[model samples]
Target: MTQTFIPAVFYRGGSSKGLFFHARHCPPDHAVLERMLLSALGSPDPYGRQLDGMGGGTSSLSKAVIIGPPTHPDADVDYTFAQVAVDRPVVDWGANCGNLSSAVGPFAVDEGLVCAADGEALVRIHQVNTKKIIHARFPVRNGKAVTTGNATVDGVAGTGAPIALDFLDPGGTVTSGLLPTGQVIETIEIDGRAFDMSLVDASNPVAFVAANDVGLAGSEHPDTIETDRAVMALLDRLRRAAAVRMGLGQTPDSVGLANPKIAVVSAPATFVTLDGRTVEGAAQDIAIRMLSMERAHRAVTLTGAMCLAVACRIEGSLPHRLCSGHADMQAIRVAHPSGIVEAGATVFQRGNGWHVESGRVYRTARRLMQGEVAIAPFEGEGDR
Candidate 1:
């Protein structure tokens, strides 16, 4: 059988990388799309290595984003994101990819779907999966997207022009409101282990638990944590419990569930980062160890960081209790495995509950390559 050639742009969006495609160039059929994307990413491999395709094996690198003309009146582009599993036939479409959302603006401008005005350009994107609007502001010089600048993100090496992403009215992204459980804190008994956690919904739905509550110091490196099977399983159970409590599912055993990310957080303390540098408490508001696809993330996610930033300001939240009282709430610096990520949310009092007007994160994106991706005829397609 002849392989299908689909045009896509391979991009490095902050810490995650994916294939960016225009909707006009992709197959409209869902069956064909599943085969195409899985083949493009080399999914369902028992070996856990996606060596036969574009995926880099890890969840962060096994992603794809589809962009096109806006379907919403307030947006300039329609963005659909997909998280393809490396070792399984699962394509999780339950949430948006905040990191890849950073690159949609540049792809829109370059694809002629939207024209950016000279100087700084503001691109309003409609995230189809979550039905949220994201406003991206990036520098445009000589009618092209600027890729280099002085902005230095913790995970990405070198500096680049800052692409400011503002997720407006970010509450209820996957759930109903900022506090999905309608409670500041909830306790669950999982397999005889009692765990306390807070569920917050800003840019995304996340379960925040104190590291100490989970028998973790919040200072362990990602490599150490990832390799420990007991620790990973323990965190997964807590995360699943949070998901059921947040109404994502009936129980932890629910099938095909993947939203409501889980993060183990703690007060800022001295910790050796992934790059061998020490992150002192004085330099960060809080420390975090978030999981993506059941594996520890090397850096904090854009959406997860946004939720943490908002949770830090709430009156009675886990992150708030852990965050060192800071004079600048707009720059909530969070220490992660990579280094420190500054995530901010425009949050304030609206009676007894918190209201987040918008959340801001600075990320940089680069168009790695733009060409046709060939998907061979495979017997099975992946599901997420």
Candidate 2:
């Protein structure tokens, strides 16, 4: 066969979109799977625009997911996330996509992977990449996951049914512990300059730095930040340095492109959002700007926001210091370029170290399309 077609479903989960497949339809060979995903997403495109495939030419849009029976006894289904690089042939499985996670339960219910009745339904998901459990709860009617509701997610237009996600025991997702270096706050040297940062790993690992230290206001638009070559280079250097310290990699170059995200943060400040709305500093507790797949994220990643919320609860962390005035609040208001998102985290210090009980957030997802995705056949591959 000149081409192969794989059954897939396209979904918009929170602020991100990805193609979903059942484990039964995927190739068992790791190498073949990588090639299929890369081709299906139109990766390795020098133009940075994935016009040839379903990808939307950004980190959040170039993604894939696999769902099957849960390997962990405590979960209902297994959800694995794959981050497909837009300009490279690499697919990073080092971390989980919190945005896409919201859709897993709905997909599972709609696809018959799980049984549900009317009213609210809960699907315990085993996040394969991070080895974590995410409890996804949403509304169900007529034996189908509800898609129409009044909930509004900042980065997404229109309203949809709200999905509440609770990440249990979210600490130490990709590193040694919540505070990877065994300190709430630490300093990393980049270009001979010492900069204070907090390396926190909750739903995902993130390196939080002061925006002022990096010569930024933390409210800059994604395009504006991406255009600044000097600032981009500096952030990458700091992120790599922190990754090494977090034990994600032995060398800076060994770190994967998706894990150990770097974020610039500051106290809430007035800023214009991508949708032309002005948000006041007083309306939010803290402001953030995060990077993913080497590009500025239009909005903060959901896991990154959850991690930031956990960091804010840590007394001495940079996020905590920035938003200390409202540190006592149960929910944290995170201001990003696209607007504001609220995340809640429960944490407390034990004799040995700090422990995170859970991180919570609300998002909406929609199934945009369901069909087979076509890809060119690889060499030596036969028709099934």
Candidate 3:
């Protein structure tokens, strides 16, 4: 079989990594695009390891991004994110990957898609999936984005330049409004039991449940959480039910694997990190454990952190009730299995309802590789 090459760049943005492509180099038809991405990432591998492709066998590592000229008037470029399932032939575009969003600006600047002078460069990004504008501010030198600095993200090792992401009006990203179900708190019954959760849609829709309600301390490592089959099954059911409530799907069985992520939250507690470091309870405002692609995430997703931050500010949400003392603080420190990540949200109550002015987080991104990714030629294409 002959192979075809597509120009792409591999980037590690925050804690997640993915392949980035220029829009001009990709086929316009989404069917063909999905096929190419699946092949390049080696999906549908029953063994759960994408050994034949670029994927690193996890949700955080199985991703693809496309960059193009802006379609929105307020943006400098267009950014689309795709989450490729490692063990299934599925590509979910229903939600945005906040971790990888940090790389879009640097990718644009380095590729000459956007011009920036030396100093703090600002790139207005049109997040296609969420229909939101993310203002990315980072340092630039010699006409390129600087990649070295003192900033460090929790999941990633070492320090790199910081990328400040301000999600403007990051409410109702994938739903009708911030409080998707028109309520700050709701109860969903699964397996003949009622579970109380907050379904908020800031940046990304998430169903936040108290850790004790799920029989957890919320400080467990990813491996420990993943090994608990009953908890995992319950979380999936809750996520699907929340998706239906948020109008992302008609029924629980029809919900996609990406959107409306389910998170378990608790008041801050002392715990040990994956790297064997100790995290004091008082150091963080709240603790969280999130699942992605049906696996316990080692660290909380950036968007999840932002959404939790926003949830903490809401009057009666579960997160707010758990961390009521820090509800009015500008920044909310979240404790995940990895450590602590700080996120901030500006929210206010209006006559209509609660309004989120913006959600902000800082991340680091670096271009790991720049070249072409080889894939088998399409079935109908002739050999070159």
Q: Highest lDDT: give the candidate number.
A: 2
In candidate 2, what are the lDDT values of residues 57-137, reduced to their tens digit?
A: 999999999999999999999999999999999999999999999999999999999999999999999999999999999
Give the per-residue lDDT digits (tens) of candidate 1, residues 202-295.
8778988888877789988777888988888888888888888888888688824357888999998988877788777899889999888877
lDDT of 3 at 210: 89
* Runs of candidate 3 exceeding 4 Å displacement: 324-327, 378-384
Q: After superposition, how far is residue 205 of candidate 1 from its true place, in Å?
A: 0.8
Q: List CA RMSD, all candidates.
A: 2.6, 1.2, 1.1
Which regions of candidate 1 fall more than 4 Å away from where they truly are? 255-257, 326-328, 380-384
Query: Which of candidates 1 and 2 reaches a greater lDDT?
Result: 2
What candidate 2 gets wrong by more than 4 Å, as runs, is 324-327, 379-384
Best of the two (2, 3) by lDDT = 2
What is the number of residue pairs that collide in model 2? Answer: 0
The best-first sequence of candidates by lDDT reads: 2, 3, 1
| Candidate 2 RMSD computed on C-alpha atoms after optimal superposition onto the true structure | 1.2
lDDT of 2 at 280: 93
Give TM per candidate: 0.96, 0.98, 0.98
